[model samples]
Target chain A: MTMNRETLINSILGLALVAVPLIALGMDEPFIITLATKVAIFAMAGVGLNLVLGYGGLVSFGHAAFFGIGGYAAGILASHALNYEPIMTWPFEVEGTTQMIVIWIVALVASALIALAIGAITLRTSGVYFIMITLAFAQMIYYFAISWPAYGGEDGLSIYVRNGFPGLNTLDPISFFALCAVMLGLAMAFSAVLIRSRFGLALQGARQNSQRMTAVGIAPFRIRLVAFVISAMITALAGALYADLNRFVSPTMMSWHMSGEIMVFVILGGVGRLFGPLAGAGLYIILEHLLGSSFEYWQLPLGVLLLIVVLFARGGLVGVLAGERKHA
Target chain B: MFTLFLEQLLNGLQSGVMLFLMASGLTLVFGVMGLINLAHGSLYMVGAFACAAVAAWTGSFWLGLVASLMAAAIAGALVEILIIRRLYNRDHLDQVLATFALILIFSEGTRWIFGSFPLFLSVPEFLTGTVMMPGEFQYPLFRLAIIIAGFVVAVGLFLLIGKTRLGIRIRAGEADRGMIAALGVDIDRLYTIVFALGAALAGLAGAFVGTTQSVQVGMGEPVLILAFVVIVIGGIGSIKGALIGSLLVGFTDTMGRFLLPHAFATFLDPASATAIGSALASMLIYIVMALVLFLRPSGLFGTEA
Candidate 1:
């Protein structure tokens, strides 16, 4: 008569997803809607990272490369549209669109292509080498972005208006939150589906034992590369939303700190868990809001808390709240 | 061209020595304990801060240097006992996270202590002037002193690792941790000493640097990345490799920036030349790394396959 963990979790998550927005609606609180929207976007980024880091076992320190690329994709496109210039032209004219559908797809594709290139070079090494190489590559990109004067460089590009959605006015706070929620839901669904698929199983297998996966007739490189690309795409989607949220995008988004923070979010949420990123993001935002509001030097306290978590609380917020699942 | 080459060579050697100081401790810690302490840089920062603060208070650079090394070593030992001991069996990701958290704590802590204002330390009077060389060129005595100091440390470390009884235990532990454990060596104590020694070396590098430039918060980060690059280019666990790799990186990085802009200026406009050259200069070492990896994936002198 007892329900299984999977079904119970699915039901609870499903309910919470619906309940959170509804609760915000009932409260009629703009602040709650804004908070929920931030959580949704960050969760999307976490889900993206979980694909490569959690499943593929690729500890890519350069993921912010994709995240920043995605933001720039959105920024450059919109700026081009605003200024009536093409992003890149061939025989056919290219134009930017405000529609989330076009924006998201373009961002995803741009990031994936870049990820493919970076992953190809970096995936050659394993272990600490991989971590540092990816980090170096990411720093290279960050520096390039900082030095390049076009598109605002270090100061960054700002969006004057929220990119449009066909049926909704994105300038409205709740409506914007709804847009992020829908994207987050879709990203979560995509991740769940991807992990359950044959490719996902193989990717997980590669992480567990790459030699065994190869012995079974799978090239771990190709599988990991694909997973890395998909992971980057998802993070890129979040980056687009994040830029839109702040109405600005800069080299800081591409910074090594941002990359570190993204990795921190994944680990804090419980690395392979479905709802972990959401939980982690929610916890992080709340901590930042509360601690940041309370003191001039709140980062000192936050650093201590993170140290405690890393040292003592290995499973993170989601793992503590739920329970540990075997590292997939 | 000869004068330019000589200047770059001296610059390269100076840069190499600074890197050697940082990389030696990093490689030693990695070789012995098999721990990647990203926070080795923080100890460097600590040394710089100590040097700057003490020199300012006491007005003796000599006293400041001594304080820097001792403070850094003590801090390193404490961190090792308190936090890093717990991380020995944990995943590398976990170690990285914990150390990264330490960096945040240390950086903010220093900022709090130092008030974000960069502190300056004047060079000692004895090392203040330039030494004349052939072809009417001159090099700063302090930079030359740094190179000599680094060479002295290198020789001392070689002696320490090769000659001392503790060095034997460290070597034995690196070769086979289980056998050393079975031999009843205090592995934990060995690890603590190794970590502290590495921290001391890092601290020395910082103290030396502080005398040359203003000591500031977050100064260790860029140097940390470069140190990582050095070890990767050198074999991860080889001290000799760290020295060679440091020279290679230091030369390439400095020379690339100097020569590339001039080379590019011949073909392109000044603005474009500056942009492209600086970018390429920054990327040169990483490019060298990629090439090295292509030929030997383990690195130039790495023991691992």
Candidate 2:
């Protein structure tokens, strides 16, 4: 309960994330506001990944599956709503809605179900096999998305208008940014609470020593699977937000590169740190903006920077700023 | 119908052979060094680029092939010494990220050097035309040559691993790193060699396939993923597994794409059937992988986890 350097840093980061966007809005710089929204959405996805990867010790390399699922869910629903068509008419009737809340719910449920199936199979293997399997599964989905032309296939689907939110102009950059930032805050708070709960303790325990946990009568598999599902839901939520932010959805969301970038956010911010994803996402977006505008081959420098972080700066930005975690 | 099936079968075998060329190196590295090199794909790209550049400059595909092997092997050795050596003891996540960074570097570096436009590598004149098969069916001679070349390399790898002192050291290194080090074997040199060997194989595959497809940046990724699928299906770290797994995947994928739409057209409307069939066909290998994992998590020939 004592105030700590990391907590202070986290507080500053959260506030700055919102304050900058607000300042951008006041200055009529909507692009900066949009960029900040991207940071928030990417950070939220990173947070989702951190739960299983950092806390549960399950390194999933295919989280983009859930992310794309969320994106496509939003895109499909919005497209159907715009076209005045039913999403499903078999067994019963299902209508598409432009409601943000409905899209979010659908995204979460769909991601959870898919994650459960994926995790049930992938979680059976550990180490390299797990990583490869997760990656392959995501690629499978990516290929499916590219070939399945109903929702635009390789071209992608774009929503003509941003989906509705009650009493708010969802089309306004500032309004959308605020919504994304708020959702990010909620996700961080939820993760913070979940990590400190008894279930969180058990999850960490399993991660540290599954054999020891088994000896103490705890089943690691179920706990990890639950964490994995929860992680997918959070990321899926971010994906939906991201799709709305761009007003478009595509298979690029589910590419292995996206998964790697998500992992980079967690690593760049310092894995397991509460605000690591925010810090990482902020730095990454800023670097992308700055380097991208100035250099033709910006990704070259980005890659070098990433290599430096992995080789020398193991703790990432948070680790550099606040020092290493006491327990770890 | 039979001729079409025969042609598809040959296509599957050819692609399967190329998959083996990639997978063997990947599985070897994972087995021997306990490392997964995502940049293995970059090395493939390196080979393709190297071959294309050399072939274009010299006007000879043969010399370009040689350049590809040397270029890729050199790149592999440098990367092993500079980056991969440090990663041997780190957890998988660190390795994954570092290699992912390497991908970015390699991809961008290639683009910087070659520009964004794809370079083409043509098959040598000797291997250019189609040949008569049983039932008077014609197949691309280049593809048939790829299958033959792949088998030749597979045999070469088997003999190298089974007969040579270096192979003994590699197998030993896989079994116990500590033991090999204690025995005064130059472990660093050995690792560098294995990594380069794997890289060379990947490069060779890239060079070969480069002729059939456009030689371009980012080409190695899909093959890399397919190789991963092959290794996973055949069981990680098993060469025999990589071969069998590669063929299984190759056959399954090629046949699925070829046959699925027609099969589905039996019931569904042609347009819808083609759409559904191709989508499912693309996903078939992963489904096979899932089923394999569901039944045998360690893979067919993998050591029990």
Candidate 3:
């Protein structure tokens, strides 16, 4: 694996430009700011998924569960704060924190806990069973969200104001965008570091050959489960940010379609690439914006495009431009 | 309480049969072709559309049913030839992505042709009423007919898979793909037949369901999940498992919804009971599946793979 210095330098330069939108505050371009924010939020989610699907060799079709859980955490917390309701009462009166940092922490913990339970069970099986079980669990959460009417249920809940940040007005577009961009960068950096770490190496190795990993004295199950939980936590945090950005959260976030779209981003960006999520999220949103504006049947064209990509192109967009699938 | 329980049980049986119709084809295809087809739901949607369209045009429910089966089978075979056949040696992810692409194409194509509005079909006049049971409870006769039809198909499938020359070929294909092909069997044609057969079953389920509810785009997805649950619970490649698994899931899901709320109401407030019960009821099937996998990872009827 020879590293190309020029290409690496160019990638860094390109990524630096991604931050240029944060500086466009004087222009008052809400549209560009919002779009960039959306791209960042989605890319963060994609990075989370790539860890499990690409690095851990586990394709969880139930990621929407974690994503939705994150959103619900933020939404439910905000609603509780707004209404002066105790979130859950016992020895402690749980109340929503208006701070973005605190909300993200709750989201991360909630998602990680659920993932831990789900992964513990799902990791016991392999192949199709694993896929179906994850899907079933996701559907369970989706149905529960729909039926539970306390916090708006199927109608979804809306946050009146964006969650706060210490020194910045979060309602301001630039501040919010910066928050999301920082989180996205952090998630991406986390992924890169994990892939280079010993656990990351073991996870990748398990994906390549579980039998050989076991023969080499590593338990593939434990390694994959840890990676899956971390992956879910990252996605969950992104979900919280996404809901804050929209000021709304609903069961739709938990829907299987959301799960599918998350996987699509990872595949579209070139599965294992560190920047692939950012690339894929950018392309997806751009296509959605463009094709949505141009024609009514945008999904049809997008579907056709995806088919061609799967059939003819082995690697995703990154593969097309950067060559073969990059090794972790 | 007893009457409501009976009604729910009957509902479960009806849903189970519909699931079996869809799952049988999927299990057979997987057993023989070693392909994981995500486009099976598309075929189901196609069938429902064909049934609804033809029923509306000709004003004949029977004709509509036949058209649905034929259209779905033909569509399935065409898909097998054009796309699925090429995917025989591909990895599961590739298969998933390709079929996922097909889903988008098929769903968008259907919406383009039919528009986004849902199409409705009426249950035939003969099966529209309710049948009185021995316990003085009445249930929808149409649902009962579905159960009967499912059993008939199950028996027919059993005879076909276990007692016929085609069955032998299918089993041979499953057991030894290379050896069977070496013996000059047209494996490609067999795969096409299996794929078509699965599509036809999905069509039948869709047609039946369309009569009860409006046929619409994305209608096949929920049923697709149930079908997946059936195959997973039954064992991926086992027809018998699909049948049993569907029944267990259907019964458990229905009964959980029916009974759990009542049980929770005994202790908790009615409002909380409803929310908590519904949430727990929804998780019941998955919990059962997790338990099953824990006890027998290969599923009840699945062979050690």
Top candidate on DockQ is 2
Tell me the tens digit of each residue's lDDT in model 2 across A227-320: 9999999999999999999999999999999999999999999888889999999999999999999999999999999999999998889988
lDDT of 3 by residue, A1-328 (tens): 2246325632863465365574555577688788888888988899999999888768788999999999998898888888888887888878876787888888989898899999998888887677777888899899889888788879999999888889999898877888888889889888989999999999999999999999999999999989999999999999999999999999999998788888888888778777777777877888888988998878888887877777887668776776764454
Two-way TM-score contest, 1 vs 3, winner? 3
Docking class of 3: medium
Best by TM-score, which number?
A: 2
Name the better of 1 and 2 by lDDT: 2
**Could you arrange the candidates by DockQ from highest to lowest?**
2, 3, 1
Candidate 3 retains true contacts at a fraction of: 0.56
Model 3 chain B: which ten-residue window has the lowest total lDDT?
B90-99
Q: Give all candidates' CA lDDT scores.
A: 0.83, 0.94, 0.86
Q: Pull out the clashing pairs in model 2.
A: none
C-alpha lDDT (0 to 100) for residue A244 of candidate 1? 83
Off by over 4 Å in 1: A1-32, A88-100, A326-328, B1-5
Clashes of 2: 0
Query: What is the lDDT for B289 in model 3?
Result: 85
Model 1, span B119-231: residue lDDT tens = 89888889999998787788888988988998898899989989999989988978998899999998999899999999999999999987787799888887888888888
Interface Cα RMSD for all candidates? 1.5, 0.7, 1.5
